[model samples]
Target: MAEEEQCNQFKKYQDYFEKQSDLMKKYDETLFDRWLHGEKGVIDQPPQHQGERRCIDFNCCHSEMDSTYSMYCQTSRVPYCHQHYSYTRYLQPPILCTSNPGINITTKFVHTSINKNKTPVYCMRWTPDGRRIVTGNEKGEFTFWNGLQFNFACLSGAHDTAVRCMTWSHSGGHMVSGEQGSNGSSSIIYWNPSLAPVVTLKTAHSELIREVSFSPNDLRFASCSDDKTIGIWDFNKQVCEIRFDESENAVYSVDWHPTESLLLSSSKGKVRIWDPRLKEKVGMFSPHKTEINKVRWNKNGKWFLTCSKDFKIILHDIRMFNKPLMIFEKHMKDVTIVNWHPIQEDFFVSGGANGVIYFWDTEHSKPIGEIPVAHDGAIWDLQWHPVGHLLASCAHDQTTKFWSRDRCGDSLEIKKYQGTNRDYDPIIPMYDDDLEQPYLAPVFIPNQINPSRINGFHDI
Candidate 1:
């Protein structure tokens, strides 16, 4: 609905509309939501030809800035047409860190793990003692590597299809493997790590097993699959002790709580914490609006993070359980995995579709650092080096690259800050129609749009 005062100010447009009153009457004059919020208010000054060319993000259609348009919406960082951009140039702008110019840290990693085996590495794991590294690739082969030289100890093809996942039993004597592709294909191999299979479990699901996590004890393990099931396997008996096939969609990932009592498994849109002993779901919730590609718990198990297809990473506090502790949105496409720094509980890294890895802090919702192109294609997995600040990112690009930091910046001493939010209910938008071009006052307009009406808020 049009605000009354603003409707009266249309006296000037009324004359022009009179020429085409019949056709104009067909559509209501209510502005789009952006204009109603007093956003993109007219830019009063043309952006000076600054040569620090800003790269266009995927959200922008054009490869570069158009000379006719000034700065677009600063918050959304997406380009808009003349009509849309002209109205949203104002409202509230973000208050950047100024107490100190806050040191800008660069993310650099020592490239140590790229083993180009002509196939993308699908999964990776470290031995319990962190002495050996095992990786499964797209071609259904496993490459066991020595921890020091990163030399291959053995390369074996035990599965007929892509080895989708791998995990070691608590004793580190046996490893569980999962595979994908080809219906009714054999899956789930329990290997003794000498290039031999201990007990090969047949496919319970029609498709691939996305993940397998050995429970804290060697007696059991949990596996989630595309068949929409989470199975708790009794390793000794070589049978699934219990199976949860209730997910409405494909189950994508699985993990065991450190306590060993709760098994965490996730499907598209929801995460369920199950008590395998009771054969019941203890807690289940949709952590993100989009598909939850991976769920990882912090070492202490107090918090866990979910990476999503919606480019959202949410940290969940098990105590609160109702709402996310914080939210991070940065990736351009689906976020495949998230791994907390084993030592640094508050920081984590997420990588997805484009092999881009983002480093985030749980206390804040934005990425503090990023590796724009860590791989050539979709990054399928991320594992932090068991010992240091280094991280391993593997992708569909057929290689695993290790990133190690040479230097981490010292913490900044932040001072007092001001917030635009008031401790009241139903807060008002920073600027309303009345303040920008108050509805109470008549508005002036030219017959056509031009940079002549450009006002404040130009990009730096």
Candidate 2:
């Protein structure tokens, strides 16, 4: 019985071996036939043009080829290839500040984000928390964007005319905007973030408003106009408490002292410092041969800086009231705008019609650095970011640029828009048939000159 059982077990093993051999033969035949006929099931063919090595694994299909490999195959026409890819390199600009080290100016700058728009940007300001940015444009529109997402969170019409100037209340609860019209309907409007104007002060001016600024305390604000007057308004009372009419030309700019209860106005060619509490001009500084375009106070309020069409920037010590402590005369064209660094009181920036910007350090009495081609055309305005070391500039080229204060080497064109478009072609030259020498005596040809008639037309 034992012998019979052993023999049966051996037969069972032999039958199992035969079955395995048959299965192997069938799989080999099927694979061979498929390879020969090029009919493998849905082969993720290794993409042609992979420059070097081709993947041949049955499960690893060519459909998973990288973008570089696909592009290489399409452009090079190489079949079933793979190669190491190289990345394009860029030279980055300098960074202004970094936490790894204390304040240093030579760090590498990486552009974190960019915001674009279709309308020309007039002004930009960051909210107190630095989470949102507000921008005013020539279309009389105001837009707010969250700094991270670059999404427009709110849009509203802040003025009927072009919104020429804007200022945020110190409390960050609302903003004040001045427009370019002077009717009763054209008044300074104050609006909250909800797109609603909560206070509209209708103290009329005879011409367009040029500038508006909020006091450091936020309880008061000032607006100047081509009417040659500056109106100081009380926010709580919503009334023009004082009107300064000392300027002979339009008041172009106004700035409040950092700590004092004084206001400064630049108009014509003079800078006037006014005491709002006393409601009178405390002092006047006339150091420019042309119009004074901008005035900015230092962080400590002990001194202020002014720039003018004379291509000069003057630093004035408020206590002396005699002459400027320093004069920057390096600009080649009109100095259109100036701004003081928010963190460094002695450092400032100036922009000009020459499309250049000067980074000035007051202590050194010279420009620390210069950026040429800052704008495509004349720069109209500039402001420093309240917290970060960034500066914003706008120009007639219909673009706004941002520069790093800590890193003067880096700059970025932030936004661009179309300016006014006008047509000039006509059917024909209008003056083609008109007399060309009517304003001058015909060159007196010796024979054609009638001396007797010349005396009668002497007035011509």
Candidate 3:
């Protein structure tokens, strides 16, 4: 019986081997067919598998196998296992917009900041082309900045004391600056940007120089001081040709007529017009309740404007001196500076001690717009760009700001040509290199006097 049982077991093993061989053959044949037709097939018999070689640590169940192990896998899928990868997310950055507001929109404060140096900036002006800006500080420092860069490129010592006032010549080739000394010695220095003063005109003014302006026509320029004198200089001769001392108080402001050969000055609540050619006063008007602080002539030269410490703007017709054609009051505090638009005759701006700037239209007594808190401290000076719609202002807080009129009309256009760069083509060439020589005589003026008199009767 034992022999019979052993023989039966051997036969059973043989039968199992045959069955496995047949299954292997069938599986190989099915895989070959699926590969040819690009289809998948299922396996029926379970094959004997060896235990995997694992890492030394029993906690690790992953097998250490050759990189080629992936090639023998039945499935073509691969899995990645990282905590950060499973929870990954993505986002896009935000965009910024800097579009300007419309014209009808009210005046808006674009920016404001206090200068850290604490040195008061007295005067500020943009370059003729509007590419750069220049500022004078009370610490006797002058800084030049390319507006786009927003950083100063050139800084130099401009004077021993504070630089009181500055004006660019019509040609934009040079600039003139006035320095107020502590010892009551005020001097005007002409700068060529390449060398020292081409012309230095010293005055006997015992106080600070208040105002300086270049003539519309290129023959001369004017400067006024607290010494109560207005000095007119001949540009060619580089000397003071006429001095007017009609004010008991200091002459605070002076402006040149745009078309005529006339000059206007304000001092001690009085406004006086002078004919430099004849060296005599032509008109005098006192319509201010308080001290006159500033005077400005319209671009058309038909009228002039004056502002006062009484918070009023008086529009004076050159022909009508007894009464202002229009008187407008907008500021609650003293009006410190008034500037007319370079091209528009109807519009002007005024700044006050309350750090407010008002834009006015003479046709209407009310202000078109106003900027409150335009500066931290009192606004000392304000100026308009010669061509564009930019306004520059200085403050006692040692900061200067630039403002642009909110004109958003599609019809607004700027056309620039190569030859159109020269605005004022002098009938004669003027340059600093020719300063060593003497100046020729100015164009002769006809001696004609108007019949209008201040006392209502002509003395002549």
Candidate 4:
């Protein structure tokens, strides 16, 4: 009687796996991990035989012992495991802007500060459609603002703690946010386009989450934390696929490549590049003298920017990162925020601890224009309008400010001279003494490759 009951249990398990195999083939293998994790409310319970080693293959019904490679799948009807299964390959074609607004840089723009919340603003992002702007505050409220008029649209209680980081999916179908850790607990929430909470992933970290970024494909997203780890999460599954626990200190920021699987992360004075598929870091370099507050990728994916508490912003070309292509040292205080133009890839802006916002053109080492006092306190976040003309900034002063160029503003008047000098007269040649100096033949020095700067470049 015992043997008969055991045989019946095996038959039940076989039938369950056969049904799963059919479902997996129709949906693809990515769902397999989700099913295992019991996410999306699709499966109410975990598999029964926890101690048994089932085939790892998506379509497999046979046990690990049945396959020579330790995995058996119904599709192949053969022995296979992770070693034989291929990783998913993702391709991202160039998503380039067709129009160009040539060399338009000026800080003489109209501006206003809005105080929708009494608490300080910690993070902000423009909606994917460019119709609304969302500002997350210290009180965990998300205030929506009209993208054009900068007026309040709506507000929602998004979290129980301060919303320290937030990101919208590329397709605008979903949004994710994280809160600063308090009382030894932190949470991450997923929302729909209407700001309605879909899932509240509680106790995501014991320490604060510093940043959250979505991948180019929008299938996966990454989160970095004060816990000194970077987590790769599946968007549909809402499960952490991998945790990179290699950082020596707190991870301050993370950004995915605009068109590739590459990920950039910053810690204390150090930056690392990671390839998520291989589950390993591919590169490392120390570009800042102190803690790096942020690292961002240009839309073109050829250049990236890093801002540091060292009071400097350094731009690096992806092809050659051994040395920075340009370093802007105009900030009088710690550089806290950096933002790239939405349309003009060469133009970017940086905000400092001194409340100053400086507009920069990558072609020049100095800022193209300056808003000497853009805010009253440390600027925590900066963003550009979808059209790339208007700028918005939030600071610890408990206010958010919008800046736009005066259509008739004199571009020449805002053109700053290079180096430690302040504003220069456009009509007067500031380097007059250099005009009389003897001309020397330009030297063509070759760039040297520093092999030690990166750990695993071949994988990139």
List the candidates' TM-scores in order.
Answer: 0.63, 0.62, 0.63, 0.67
Please give the lDDT score at residue 11 for candidate 3: 55
Q: Top lDDT: which candidate number?
A: 4
- Looking at candidate 4, the ten consecutive residues that score lowest on lDDT are 451-460
Give the candidates in order of lDDT, highest first: 4, 1, 3, 2
Per-residue CA lDDT of model 3 for 1-460, tens digit only, reads 9768656654553455466654365545544354347442212222222113221111111231133234324422112111121211110000000011112111322223234456788877767765667788898677775544334457777877888888888787778888776676887888874425677767535678888888887678898998889999887888888999975888989888877789999997899999998999998879796789999888778788889999999898887778789998879998988887665557678889888888776765666456766786778888665543456678887877765432111111111110010111111212234243221111211222111100000000
Q: What C-alpha lDDT do the candidate models reach, one value each?
A: 0.62, 0.59, 0.61, 0.68
Considering every candidate listed, which one attains the maximal TM-score? 4
Report residue 283 deviation for candidate 3 (angstroms).
1.1
Predicted candidate 2 versus true structure: per-residue lDDT over 318-437, tens digit per residue: 887567799887799999888776655566778898877777667545564556666666777776555434455666665655443122111122111211001111111112233321
* Winner on lDDT (1 vs 3): 1
Error of 4 at 75 (Å): 55
Worst 10 residues of 3 by lDDT: 91-100
Error of 2 at 272 (Å): 1.1
Model 2 steric clash pairs: 48-79, 48-80, 49-78, 49-79, 50-81, 50-82, 95-107, 96-406, 96-407
Off by over 4 Å in 1: 1-107, 112-117, 193-195, 407-460
Off-target runs (Cα >4 Å) in candidate 3 are 1-106, 111-116, 193-196, 406-460
